[model samples]
Target: MGNDGGSIPDRRDLVRTKAKAEQADKANQTRARWFFCALSKRRLEEPIVACPLGRLFNKDALLEFLLDRASYGADGAAVAGHIRSLKDVKELKLTANPATKGKGKGRGEGENEETPKFVCPLTFKEMNGAQPFAYLAPCGCVFSLSGLKSLSSAKEKEPGKEGSTTPEKDEEQLELCPQCGAKYSKSTDIIPLNPSPDDESLLRARMEAKRAAEPKKSKKRKAADPESSDPPKKKKSSPTAAPTVNPNIAATSRAVVTSLALEEAKRKAGMSDAVKSLYGDPSKPKQKETFTTMGTFTRYA
Candidate 1:
């Protein structure tokens, strides 16, 4: 067909247009692939300690034996080396998959997207960071100590400067967990960043309260006389009247009493004579025994 000015384009023109479109599409695909590869490669190269997975990898083990301990924290080189070690172990299947693959819309999607176990409690980020403490991995999630005390104080409603005493003006002052966004009270028990004044104050208050609760010693009382002590006193019994006796029995008793009195008088006389001889005084008044009763005496011719 001859070239009609407004007619449909020839087969060659259509072919050219299709070719250019395909080239453009191929370029876009290449760009996207490079972008994804760079991003993935960067993530793979990032320090494991900076990622939540670092907690599982054993930082001390890696540091003491594998990497330098002094250079472990905040060291880009050490972090990179640690990450490479992890990648090698994972690729070799030395370390089993710590995370379970989540279900996806398609078969490959599940394998591509795996969710990690044991998320960071502080950051709620992908648990990427150094072990024990979360740090930002190149993967974007991190556990940070920066502003941790401030963050905690904010949650406790006591936000202030490093040493300032300003109470938390509002709840917004505290830093919420980036993951679960849970709030914590200001204390060392919650956050390990730095010592909080609230914790110190609480400790001091507890000590004071304990001291106040303790029992006190009482003052001593004066001693009292032994005679006037609380124990009861004994009473003396009065003398009883002499009993009446039969004539025979009275007579016999009188005879026995007379003999006993005579013997006793002899003993007293001897002792008195000895005492008089020693002192050279014979007429001294003799000691008398007081009598409780008197009996009738009988005389024989």
Candidate 2:
């Protein structure tokens, strides 16, 4: 089959490059991760927060996710199941990209509309999730690694204008942000953004250490007012008189009473004669009937 009307295979059909396919896949993944929020699937916005797994999310979206997990549907649980609270994420403080032309700023020339929102303030370089970027812990200002290194070198070479300030003092002292003038510990405060595995570990350890140094919250509760808390004394249920019994309601049946009396007599009958005489026998006892109704009988007669 010559390259006639029968078949005309294009370069794309002939060449199936594995490397190209892989690269495309990687680019797609990168765009998915860096350009959109992991939870909400919206365009990435600043005050961005990243989880331990390095998934980026908008701060508000993350807060929403944390507040109500069911809001984002089934994918919410799958994506943010690890994120129990805000503590699980690190809020990124981004530097404004100076090269980024605002609306109606640069309509002509080489202005890219899809430029990154945040960039290294020092280098004037776009972050774009590819470059090695870092932030000052104290001031939360961000800069490119190369820019920071260059700045650090320049600061080292520059002679201390004041007599008191020395090179050794500069090395030992805190790094002040050129943009914000915020002080940060040079050794510990420069945390790399979206760092590699090892760098992430170190950053996490530093974060934990910094948190440990902070004062712990008091667990003890404040005491309420004594007057408000104390309950009123209840009157000693004035020794309730043994619930008054109803005279009309017989406590025991007549037959039951008689049987009880007969049982008592039988018990007393078993006693010795001498003891019985001392205790007195009720059956043998006889006495004349006496009446105390003297006024009623005299009046009637």
Candidate 3:
């Protein structure tokens, strides 16, 4: 068994290809991110969405993944754990790649025939995660930065019935999306795709300012005090005195009053002496209770 075309290779004898392996791994990762959905491991398709972490996804595929996370296997949680709902990722408005004739499969026989799925609708530039792109926050229409600038420049040069517009007017005006014609404030609506640190800071500041500008709900007022605010209504005096009763009627009224008084007196007479004492006669003097113990204790003893 001594070196018979087989020998136990020592660690030093083996080739140290760690650097090549790392490079290959990096290349594969880049390709995967650009060409495949990060969540589904399928070919990227519109409407594509990107998370805050810059991972790409197909919108429908992401939804499916969200609805049933177990369907994508154990790696699903690791890949799309951050996306709890639709708000976690922005739905990308992709510009169709004009160079891409059709959706051709990209493996095995026709690997070279595969074309980009989308491009900047303005300059017809390819959007394969390499170029600088932007989207309108209001309409979500994606375009290359250069293409957008060109379009803006063209707009500025276009003569209106009045004449060429001023730069100040341009800053104040709203920009309409070419794709959807949605009106968006140019100052705040343009959001860069895969924004840099500075761009993200500016976006955050803009968002804060927008939120601050919104009017807060005022507290509901308590019910009004109707009595306090209103003046007391003056009661009207009678026009004439009440007519005097006939002698016969007056006599009958007096008789009824006398009978009621007599009944009340009879009721009082039947009441207990203790109850009667509560309403004692005013003419009677209250009896003074003398303490006789001092005199009686010595004298009587």
Number of the top candidate by lDDT? 2
Question: Which candidate wins on TM-score?
Answer: 2
Q: Candidate 3's residue-wise lDDT over 191-233, tens digit each?
A: 7765666875676576555544542211111112333232222
What's the candidate order when arranged by decreasing lDDT? 2, 3, 1
Give the local distance difference test score of model 3. Answer: 0.66
The candidates, ranked best first by TM-score, are 2, 3, 1
lDDT at position 28, candidate 2: 72
lDDT per residue (tens digit) for residues 1-301 in model 2: 4778988876775565666888889777666666688889887888888764556789999899889989998899877776768876767767656656464375543344356667877777887767777766666577888888888888777765633677677667887787789887777767766577788677667655655454222111112232224321112222222222332235555667889889668755875774454344455333111233324322432
Cα displacement (Å) at residue 221, model 1: 60
For residue 41, model 3's alpha carbon misses the true position, in angstroms, by: 5.8
Better of 1 and 2 by lDDT: 2
Stretches > 4 Å off in candidate 3: 1-34, 38-42, 50-56, 61-90, 102-114, 162-164, 204-301
Model 1 regions lying over 4 Å from their true place: 1-118, 122-153, 156-301
CA RMSD for every model? 30.3, 14.1, 15.3
